[model samples]
Target: MAGLSRPLETELTFPVRTYDIDFAGIVSNIVYVRWLEDLRVRMLERFYPIEPLLARGEGPLLARTEIEYLRPVRFGSTVRGIMWAAGHGRAVFDLQADFEVAGETVARARQRGVFVHYGRMQVMPLPKELRSQMESAPASSRQQGG
Candidate 1:
């Protein structure tokens, strides 16, 4: 399968474990969502420095998430997690992710997160610094030559 490229994205790799699989020997639905979330957070930390941004009382918080399972992921399979910002608005941004095994897509997910003030817990615009940093970061391995 061909890899899809997007701007300002990150890819993480993991091996499917026996525990991640269901009785049918395929990855459980819940595990797929968790993996997607893990990759999304990793991308945020890698490119946007979410920990520091949160420490400063500013960062994006997950507001909603949706997942679509396209194929089965079996135990012992090596999976790749690809994550990137799909869209951004004044207060909310959409993070998109895909799980693939042997270059075949198993699932896709999208998370809508909003920048919020920690103290007030109110939605806020993404900081210019964070946005700029994310925008400047490399989007996909295809472009960077993995």
Candidate 2:
């Protein structure tokens, strides 16, 4: 398993949309959660598309999430979300992310997850192929083409 894991990181940048703001005039707390979810999906797309995972009868499910909002993000501000896998053990894994605007981190988050067998809802071991990709991907390589 050691040969198949690493501190894999990636990021995505998007402008804050009108709907992302709350009545308080800043991006809503839930919007940051959505951004983190999107980041995870994009990471999967880069390393392991969902279609194949589903075909294998396995998929990841969130078991926990933790976030600390450092600053409010305003409408039209371009925020970059950086996500990375922090660690894993057998069927469970951990991920971390940060939301930044103009290089200043506005929020930081962590997620705990488990890969489950689709039909049985039983925890499954992390796949070696996925682990190999994670272990080999260069941290400096920002996922290209969105």
Candidate 3:
């Protein structure tokens, strides 16, 4: 574990739009879901692109999602979200994210997903390429320890 590189984290930012707020002037719960979806898409786009997976007729599907609001996000606030592939099993891949406003945590979310064969509707194992990328350090970020 000491020698293994940390998992790749994908960070993104979102502004609290007027449409994202509720009558109470706080971000709606559904908006968090949308942001989570965006995080997942960006994660894929940054790492293993979705185009190839879709072309192969296999792609990840969200099996479950859980989000906890720690603080209210008001309008004019920008949320910074950082997500990473927490871990994976034979078929299930887990992702974790934290949304922070001005360096303070506003919410935390987790997503459980699985890859499936489109036509057959069968589960597929996690791709080695993805696993390796997540486990290896980024070339630019890798630094020798003293």
Top lDDT model: 3
Top-TM-score structure, candidate number: 3
Candidate 1 vs candidate 2: the TM-score winner is 2
Model 3, runs deviating above 4 Å:
1-6, 136-146
Residue lDDT tens for model 1, 1-146:
14635645788888888789899989898987788778877776766667777787987788888999898878888999888877665566667788888879888898877788889998887778655644643444111210
In TM-score terms, candidate 3 sits at 0.86
Please give the lDDT score for candidate 2.
0.80
Pick the winner on TM-score between candidates 1 and 3: 3
Q: Give the higher-lDDT candidate: 1 or 3.
A: 3
Instruction: List the candidates ranked by lDDT, beginning with the highest.
Output: 3, 2, 1
Can you give the lDDT of residue 52 in candidate 3?
A: 86
Q: Candidate 2, residues 1-146: lDDT per residue as tens digits? A: 12323456667887999999999999999998899998999889877788988987889999999999999899989998888887666667678898889989999998988889979998887778665655544545323221
Residue 138 Cα positional deviation in candidate 3, in Å, after optimal superposition: 16
Task: Write candidate 3's Cα lDDT for 1-146 as tens digits.
Answer: 12323465788899999999999999999999999999889889878987888999999889899999999999999999888777766667778889999889999998888888989999888777886765554444332221
RMSD to the native, candidate 3?
7.3
Query: Which TM-score value belongs to model 2?
Result: 0.84
Residue 42, candidate 2: how far off, in angstroms? 0.7
**Model 1 per-residue lDDT at 44:** 68
